[model samples]
Target: MKRLYHWPLDPAGRLVRLALGERGEAFETLESPPWSPHPDISRLAHGAVAPAIVDLKTEPRMFACGTRAICEHLAETGDGTALLPESAADRAEARRLWAWVEAACEEVTDTLLTERVMQWVRRDRQPDSARLRRGAHALRGRLTFMNGMVEINGYLAGRQVSLADLAAAAHLSAYDYFGDVEWDAVPDLKEWYARLKSRPSFRPLLADRLKAVRPVAHYADLDF
Candidate 1:
């Protein structure tokens, strides 16, 4: 059995989970909160981080740390649906957009999600209003850009589902868990998200919940 270490709300971790689910790979999951990661993670070849995977089926035990490495590894090894496109050009486009989604959402995660995690999960500090405001501003900009892309191309890269869609959806779903997304402001993106949410691969994420923190009412509602 394969073992995966991840944080429930981490976009990178969520992306890896979605990729694994999409590929129909079964694996055991161990939660490794960002504030207090699993000790084994620090002993890995790569620096400590959630979303790391250890393929126990391999001869010497293959290990992959971080989203890019893990996701690409799964794409190469798994035999279900292809996450990356077939054509070189399309693959390049998907990769470019996938990278863009992570880079673009960095601010939102660093600010808003960080504040929430600190305040609620860790109970370490008070919520920072400035960070929350900044994150909200950045999220709106990203939502508008994504909405435009979906409105024109139906998907982030093209018609076919790709890594870009999964990456974007993973990030958006994290924010949506906290009801941070204003779906009314982006109808096209909202519709797109609803479709993604209805997929079988998304069920696990929809069921994820922190100890004392509850998700939005519509977080698990596919129709919403």
Candidate 2:
């Protein structure tokens, strides 16, 4: 058995989950919010962050932290379709876009998603309008760029699904959970997302729900 510590809404966590799910690997999930991680996380040297994984099946055990470490480990060990492309050039392009998605979405997550989580989950503050606006503005720019890429290449890195597509979808899915993504504004990207949403690996994320917060109606709708 393998165990995963993650926050449902964290894009990095979602990326790991997607990779694991795509590989058809079963893992027991333990929720670990960034503000207050699971106590067991302190025991593993490389499991300090959410999205960490521990392979209980291994004799000496194996642990990995963060998206890069976890996803790469799974890609290497699992007997499923590779998340990274086979061609060297395509693999490099996928890695580049994977890094780019995280960098680009950092602002949106720090602002919009953080504010939403603070306001609803923490329930200790009001939503910051200024931060929300800033996040939305940044999100629009990212969506536009992604839309162009999908329009030209069918997927972020190429015709086949790759880490780039999964990474971008993970980030965008988090935003979409809050109804923050303006799908109409980026038609090509929206179409691409619909295809991703229909995947079996994406079902668990669509079903995620916070205690006091409800997702938007279209969050789980594959057609939307």
Candidate 3:
């Protein structure tokens, strides 16, 4: 069986879970908190971290350390709806958007999402008002850009679902878990999210729960 080491709220980890689910691959998860590294992570490699995967099914145990490595690996090996588009140009566009989502969400995750996790889950300190505000401000900008893309193309890169959609959904879903997303502000993006949220691959993500930090009421609501 394959084993996935991941943090429940990490967008990268969630993205991998969604990809696995999309491929109908069954794997067990071992929690690797972002604040506390899992022992097995270092065992996999010197600086390996959560969102890593180890395939014990392989003779020598195939392993990957990051989203790019793992998702691309899965896309190559899995037999199902391609995670990437077929055309060369389409593939390039999808890859570009996929990278962009991660880059663009980095600020939001580091500030807003990180502060929320620290305050609610760890309870180590009070939430940082400045960081939260910064993250929210950055997130709004990203949402507006994404809204325009989906409004014009029906998806991030094109009409068909691709890794770009998954990447965007992963980050957005994490923010939504904490009720950070202002859905009303971007109606088109909200509609697009509703469609992705209703996918079968999204079921496991909807079920995710952080014991100390519960998701928002609408986190799991497909219609929301």
Q: Which regions of candidate 2 are displaced past 4 Å?
A: none
lDDT by residue for model 2 (127-148), tens: 9999999999999999999999
Which portions of model 3 show Cα errors greater than 4 Å?
A: none
The TM-score of predicted model 3 comes to 0.98
TM-scores of the models, in the given order?
Answer: 0.98, 0.97, 0.98
The candidate 2 region of ten consecutive residues with least summed lDDT is: 42-51
Model-by-model lDDT, in order? 0.91, 0.91, 0.93
Question: Largest lDDT belongs to which candidate?
Answer: 3
Give candidates' CA RMSD values in order.
0.9, 1.1, 0.8
Across 49-146, the per-residue lDDT of candidate 3 in tens digits comes to 78999998998899998999999998888776789999999999999999999999999999999999989999999999999999999999999999
| Candidates arranged by lDDT, highest first | 3, 1, 2
Whose TM-score is higher: candidate 2's or candidate 3's? 3
Reference-based lDDT, residue 159, model 2 = 95
**Of the candidates numbered 1 and 3, which has the greater lDDT value?**
3
